[model samples]
Target: MSFDYDLFVIGGGSGGVRAARLAAAEAGARVGLAEEYRMGGTCVIRGCVPKKLMVFASGYSGAFEDARAYGWGVQAGGFDWDIFKGKLEAELTRLEGIYTANLKKAGVEIHAARATLSDAHRVKLSTGEEFTAKHILVATGGRPFVPEFPGHELAITSNEMFKLDQLPKRLLIVGGGFIACEFACIMNGLGVEVTQFYRGAQVLRGFDDEARGHVADLMRDRGVNLHVGTDVISMEKTAEGIAVKSSTGHDASYDAVMYATGRVPNSDGLGLEEAGVRLGRRGEVIVDAYSQTSVPSIYAVGDVTDRINLTPVAIREGAAFVETVFHGRPTSPDHELVASAVFTQPELGAVGLTEEQAREREPIEVYSAAFRPMQTLFAGRDDRVLMKLIVSQATRKVLGCHIVADHAGELIQLAAVAIKMGATKEDFDRTVAVHPTMAEELVTMKSPTRTA
Candidate 1:
């Protein structure tokens, strides 16, 4: 009947912190949040920020090489990796402090320890202190998955990759997911010899087949040894270095091996069972549309739900939950027509449905445009761009939009807004094209490549 706090949140990541801050500020509720690790969570510390910085850093080598074409007469000078690492470390420390300050500003009590639910409405911290609340929220997020192979222990996960003492001269990446691709690009572009092996026939299995093929071609041309439909069976450390034996009858050597296979929900060691909370397959917390878990007084959000593993998606879910439950505004994410981008060299941005996914329904008209971007013409680069739109035959509603080229991520944002608004193919034609922009191809495609 009585509670010590209005809400007790586990995990100080994006979802947990957002819920706590909003509950205190909007609902005037007393909130307590605990995080065993850093404050800013994966995105700020190990995932997005650091990864993007590496992306930027890696891109410079290419830029420098391309400078000569622009008559800049650039030459390679001795480069130091430690300097970049030190700068990135400083930036991470600053970001962590900001996350801490944000929580304090919202008047939420912060506990620097892991929190486990002891009962339906009670949470116990590692320090043996127990807190009771009317509601408890779990947002512990997820962890990278490294499979067991012969000498699996020799491989490192993404978390370890972030803290490597020295960058490997030759790196072997095992997996075809976004993390693996992003890291492969980063290291290879930075002059590390990288060989990426994927068990599936394609690297980005969910993306359009043509897009995957084009990206694979570009990666290979950029000096990445990409192996698809191959699996690692064993690894051995030789006097020369690490040797990898593949199930597809391939052998390779590298300074280090990274397994970016996938990630599972961080639901372990949290005593969910002790608290009567239910978890679905892969140990993801079973939550309702409102993010309330099976137990009425308990809720879960973020990667722990395993619904949408993106950082922005997690933040939106956390905000929506508070709005619906505590702030008197009912809201939910549609999760459809969501735009996403892969940060490979040329990049890939997509929204709505894939042509393959759209083909299962009634016949759809698919329009595609591919050409060298105008910028590349003047810049004297041979890089090309591909843009596509999938439209319903009957309704003419744009079913999907995809792009593979520079600024794809930036371009997809507006397309996502259009898709979210249910804009049709005619709507794109009605809008005036931005002259000479790569994205204008999306609106300018006059004919369907094929009707299915």
Candidate 2:
């Protein structure tokens, strides 16, 4: 079959851009990519990058307080939403330009419009260009999902939060996931009276139980009105802003309400089913270990496949896709023991399995330490931190590692390497402790607190 390009990628997200660049420049295969909005998709444009900036920006309030305790005359001024928002938008624009520049440099054609599947090996772009490729890659990623309800339009999603012109004086956040709790902390630190409602018993539902509890406790202690076992029954608009009725029988009014309930894979209206591609109930594309779809020429990776939604994971998946299809090397993206972080202050960084998850599948031992970090204690704040290890009883390998402290995200990333290589509890014991550091707790805990 005559093909205009060897690979045609839909959605120029992390996965698509990586795949397109490698296949075109390295593998010497003609590749084309199209994105409806910006070149960097969600991560660079909206989600992780901007959100982390806000998290950092919001934390200065506490920083100034800590400085005062250290005998420094640090006075915190009011947060200026306009200045921060302008800078954030500028940074995102810079990042988007980099993504586009890289794609162009790699010799991949970029379409500044939407593209979708016409068939197994063809793509139709919004610019009225139809192209046939030897292979089609779907990397459309996902979007924030806000459930339908009465007056739902009065609330915004995480997407809109970044674009809000002014910070709300009173903000109500819904859902208990990492996003919800993170924003709760961010808003609270930014001097907003933040209230969070989650129907679940706790926030961070899938994380280590003890670690999540520490985050919840600290969030509440740090001034987030966290109301678990509660959810919004309805929200309405009024002069005060959003009037919220909680299922827990609480009624309140807020300047803004945000729903961070979840996200859905961006697989709809792409003509995948018509092309004989299989999809899961959540509209996620069904793919093999190598990311090949039901049709030989059609493939998917990243959030579109509903795999690990991390940007690095998506990039790895994309590289694996190029290797398997174009380079003739059979490779399946390794998803095991992937590390993750929840950006809620004193962030949570973790890898492998939670104690609950490990115990459900096998015998395990848990070691945990919860204490106030020296800095926070010095600042006269009762803020606490936790470090835990979940170890497999049978193999004695560290099954999971969780940390709730400052820079947990950066720490967990390094620990993930050792855990991924199957580091055991004894191996951790063999390492000497780094003194006077929060992470030293990881090495110094001499005994298991419990076993299951």
How do the predictions measure up, each by TM-score? 0.97, 0.99
Best by lDDT: 2
Candidate 2: global Cα-lDDT?
A: 0.92
Worst 10-residue lDDT window, candidate 1? 374-383
* lDDT, candidate 2, at 358: 93
Please give the clash total of every predicted structure, in order.
Answer: 0, 0
Off by over 4 Å in 2: none
Task: Residues 1-452, candidate 2: write the lDDT tens digits.
Answer: 79999999999889999999999889999999989998888888878999999999999999998999999987777899999999999999998999899889999998888888888888998999999999999999999888888988888989998999888999999999988988999889899999999999989998988999999998998999999999888888998788899898879999999999988999999999999999999999999999999999999999989988899999999999999999999999999888999999889999999999999999899999999899989899998889999998899999999999999999999889889889999999999988888988998888899999
TM-score of model 1 vs. true structure: 0.97
Worst-scoring 10-residue span by lDDT in model 2: 113-122
